[model samples]
Target: MSEAAEKFETAMPAWKQWQEAPWGRLRYAIAEANPLRHFGERADEPLRVLDLAGGDDGDALRLAVRGHHVTIADYAPAMLTAAAGCVAAAGLTDLVSCVEADANALPADIVRGEFDVVLCHNLLQYVE
Candidate 1:
């Protein structure tokens, strides 16, 4: 595998495990930084939001609950799987989409400007 792909593979287990924690769930439910504030007055619109490195905690789901269409993107398949369950449980399946994708090289399926709100929380620290 390429270096980036290998890194993602290695990171999957730890990411999955972390998502099982209470703190993880809490953090996702209440993101440290409020996205609504950053979106400014435009928050009223039907926003397309991207939560990069969203893991399985469902921060994207929370955003969706607030009337945004959110995409939960993560490099780990396990994370995506768990996120799917979370989305379903929250009845957010219609508003949230979980995608298996790296933060560094986001998939082409995620179009540029496709998202009005892009969250990179806790992701940049790992990338560099």
Candidate 2:
């Protein structure tokens, strides 16, 4: 893993806690509207989305709830575990999936061009 990824992996526990807090939920609620606004005309269609460095997959769950297929990818395995739990809790197993991967070097199976939308919120600052 890259240095940034390792650092994030170490911080996953704290991250998970904060993500369940009010502010985190608020942040996701605010950001969730973007995809719908942008894809307003295609509301009936199921869009494929990728949430890069999407720890805990809160945002992915939101998108999935909107009827989109979402993949939450993070370098931290713990984050993916938490994300999986969120997916299950939301009962969105058919719409959301998790992948452990480095954002700097994502696996070929998750090419950017394959997704209709790519959510990269709050991830760039950690990239190196």
Per-residue lDDT of candidate 2, residues 1-128 (tens digit): 66766776798778778877999788888888776788878866899988998887878887888799988889877678878988898899999888888887788889734898888988888766
For each of the candidates, the C-alpha root-mean-square deviation to the true structure, in angstroms, is 3.3, 2.0
Clash statistics: count for each candidate: 0, 0
Per-prediction TM-score to the true structure, in the order listed: 0.74, 0.85
Worst 10 residues of 1 by lDDT: 1-10
Which pairs clash in model 1?
none
Q: How accurate is candidate 2 locally (lDDT)?
A: 0.83
Could you tell me how far off, in angstroms, the CA of residue 105 lies in candidate 1 after the best superposition? 1.8
lDDT of 1 by residue, 1-128 (tens): 45654575678777656666887667665673477767788777779888888876457766777778888888777667778898899888899888878777777888564677788877877777
Runs of candidate 1 with Cα error greater than 4 angstroms are 1-33
- Identify the candidate with maximal TM-score: 2
Residue 124 deviation, candidate 1, in Å? Answer: 1.7
